[model samples]
Target chain A: MRQDIIEIRWHGRGGQGAITAAKVVANAVFKAGYKGVVMAPTFGTERRGAPVFTSLKISREKIYDLSPIETPDMVVVLDHTLLEEVDVTHGLKDGGQIILNTPKAIDTYDFGAHKLSISDVTSHALEAGLAPGIVNTGIIGAFAKATGLVSRDLLREAILNEFSVMKPEENARAAALTYDRTVIGGA
Target chain B: MHVIESGNVAAATGVKLARTQVIAAYPITPQTPLTEKLSEFVESGDLPAEYIPVESEHSAMAVCIASSTAGARSFTATSANGLLYMNEQLHWAAGARLPIVMCVANRGVGAPWTVWNDHQDTVSQRDLGWIQLYCADHQQIHDTVLKAFKLAETVSIPVMVCYDGYLLSHTYMPFDVPEQEKVDAFLPGFEPTHFLNPEKPRNFNTVTLPDVRPDLHGNTAPGYMEIRKTLHTDLRAALSEIEKIDGEFGEIFGRGGEPFLEPYCCDDADYVAFCMGSLSYQLRDVVDAMREEGIKVGVMGLKVYRPFPDAAVREALSAFKGVIVLEKALSYGNQGALYADVKSALYSAETRPFVHNYIVGLGGREIKTQHLYDALTESINKEAAVGDEPRWIGLKL
Candidate 1:
């Protein structure tokens, strides 16, 4: 659903790397020739494992407003449990898209009015030697492949440039694995 | 070269490019990243400056004052409580006329404890006699720092380059990073008019009486009265110098903002909004949207808050029948600080505009472009009460 001006909302708990993912994507989008990019986390100072969100806007035109995005073109869920906890598609456009981290196949989930993209980014993270939680960056690889909104090379570069993990190559590998393994449905 | 930078890093970059001599800093949210970047630069030898690791914000300001007294181009940055803590030194720096430049990542004043964006911190210190420059974006922050040093050094008045915390402080945008040689050509080396040295020990304002006094060399010098008079006079005089310096910078660097204020679509404006900082960017967009709706809306962004551009503001507001003063800071019992400033500036105008003051986005509360339209609509609909309290917008009753 990326267009001239696309607003993306990311759903994840605190410490799940939602904010970092948003920044990385925005930076990558900038690297991919779309100049105006903005990303911001929710205003709450800090609380781990709490329901939180981050929003990003990548545009071909110069963006003036600093206000947080109200309606999103795409929503990425870093935490799967957030599906039951909150209305993830609160102000989404009619033909908006949803990219999620889940084990269920493309046929199992009913994503109301959204073109669904599924990736087991968590498994990729585990393969990359990461902990059980926080599949934020890994999901971005699937995001790039499923939507074609961002470049794969730029996604890998963004993860490597931004993420300061123990084994950064692992983060890059996780992104690549998820990008190839992602399945699209109900477009 | 063009680079995508956050506000904090942009500021740090400015300090680095200006080649500040002494950077005394203490960490605080939003502003911590800026000082940390400076620390990294200092450690990496990219910025060859003495980076002081101070105990508190109080000590940080004290270090700047001490360094400035020793004739070093000094720089320091802090936020809300840190700025509040340096209140006494803030006066001392301005009173002593040290051309120290500091970046105040504008934040809300804490009472119940909040670390969000607002002008309460910087606006509260408007009385302390420092030239305050507010930036709308990272580009401005970068360019202004170069200009600020020149302005500060030329006028011998300290300057506070302020921007909204978290909003500009954390947000990213691509901006033209000026070449080092170009910056060097634009901003000259620091020249201290007077300093304390042991070998050539000249007494510098130990205890000036109310009137003029003679020095050891039998040269007559003005005392406290004249010193205070010169401070105000020089600040007022810098208005022209601000424009001149901005013009010169623009000519060389290819980008410079009007140091005092920027008027947007105000030529035929009947109703205008008065604002400053990042919110002004949003206000400009809101003005465009309202114009599409045929509201005749215009926006004038106040870039310089200190030595308040009274004449420019008066002229800008004179064309409009209604001028809504929107600010991120509040004055609690009284009206918003900026509203009072606007009211006073327009007090003597022949055609006094109806000025409505409102505070929004305090403590970094979300303010959308829609809120601007709402504020303007309500201000236009409501009657002008000359002596009433300024309304607080977006409060849940």
Candidate 2:
């Protein structure tokens, strides 16, 4: 397949930092001298544990339309339970990749994608003494490995810009571990 | 200094400049970013305030009421369903007469839910006894927040600073955020004479006996009579305070649109259109085009919706042959509610013009300038038909 702009759809709960993940990705794209549209399609009252989806459209051109992406190029499931909550693979294009946050085997569920379970994301974060909320940074690292859409240097720069002020060294360690263990499943 | 900012950010900056001490809010569409930005200020140590992440909109208003009564400059914001959810405390905020400034990003209330710009949310709260100030642009959003605090505190009533949901909330424009020290000098910290302090405990909303009931109004009796008089008097008081606060704010902020009614091309016109909220800006554009074509039409925007600003409206509209009231909200029985009030204001004038009411947007429907232009074009033909009652623009069959 020809390499082009990568569109990512993030699925997770409200307080799971899904929105922040999209922003980090956008910031990464922006630092790469590209454009990224970070949009969160929120509904009803903001309740904890409610399923929330945020989208990031990273392109070399200016991103204008913010509507829901019918066919996302890459789908990052921040919460594994959201798979049963809605059809996560509804309009996912063929040859697209799915990055499940769980460690279970990809074929354990019938989700129709070349799936890889980045299960070590949480444990590695915990190993680094980073709390559970840093899974998003791990997801970014796995995303960079899976898609190769963004440079590791650019993603590292974006993560540092975002979280370096809060928890710097632990997140940098988490990003390094994530970049190493993210293995590609069957295509 | 002029900075490019979203309407939500602009309003938040206004609240920060006003030195709001407490912000209790639950996030809602078109309004979440306003509070989110304020929360950022609190987190970044830029603004020193209590940002309470409330459970629901009801609790949001409750927090605002309690905090404001305790001598704090409190603020909260919501849109659509969130405002409707805060229904009961809306009455409490007014009944207790707390001067809480709320920014209402006007949205459509739902059954079949929608998240778009409309006047349903703010318009439905017209009878809640709070002063309503509709804004036209980003500058007005900043001006209205500062003025609203003064008006609310002066009238001893709450005030709603309303703007179109997405039109103003999401759009970015150049905003002039005043210096904090200058704003502090303009609006000193509020110190309440009566607070829920442990040392000076007092009953807030207690039941009164019949004999003492009449004392609330003194000259006027109790029930609807006294309530109406109090509302009218308080609303009139709010209008004067609105003008006075605008003058002071103008001195500090250096931009002064009319604090009450903004008249556009009304001087030498035979016909005029009355609109509120962001539509007035759209109407002004139409008025300019019509003026260039020598249509002799003008635009009048109502900012203070409570006191009705009757005199200002009558003086500006009396010279026209007919007046067109473009309403986004409706009263089931009569004409557009504001049109009825405007008619009452114009009734005794010597040369009263004919009034036409065009109800265009209800459930967050898009209202184009052409729709307004079409309504005016129709009114020009049917001016004589409108005697006392007004006409609807795009009523559903």
Cα lDDT listed for each candidate: 0.86, 0.76
For residues B14-103, what per-residue lDDT tens digits would candidate 2 score against the true structure? 998888899999999889889899999888878899999999999999999999888898999999899999999998888777899999
List the TM-score for candidate 1's chain B.
Answer: 0.97
* TM-score computed on alpha carbons, candidate 1: 0.93
Q: Would you estimate the TM-scores of all the predictions? A: 0.93, 0.67
Show pairs that collide, candidate 1.
none
Off by over 4 Å in 1: A1-4, A47-51, A82-87, A126-134, A163-169, B203-205, B382-388
True contacts kept of 1: 0.52
Writing each residue's lDDT as its tens digit, candidate 2 over A1-187 gives 1134466788878788776666666766666666423343443355788887766666675332333466787788876777889666667778777777766655576544445545457767777678866687777777777777668888787778778677876776676687778767765
- Checking candidate 2 for backbone clashes, the offending pairs are none
Residue B283 of candidate 1: its Cα lDDT? 84
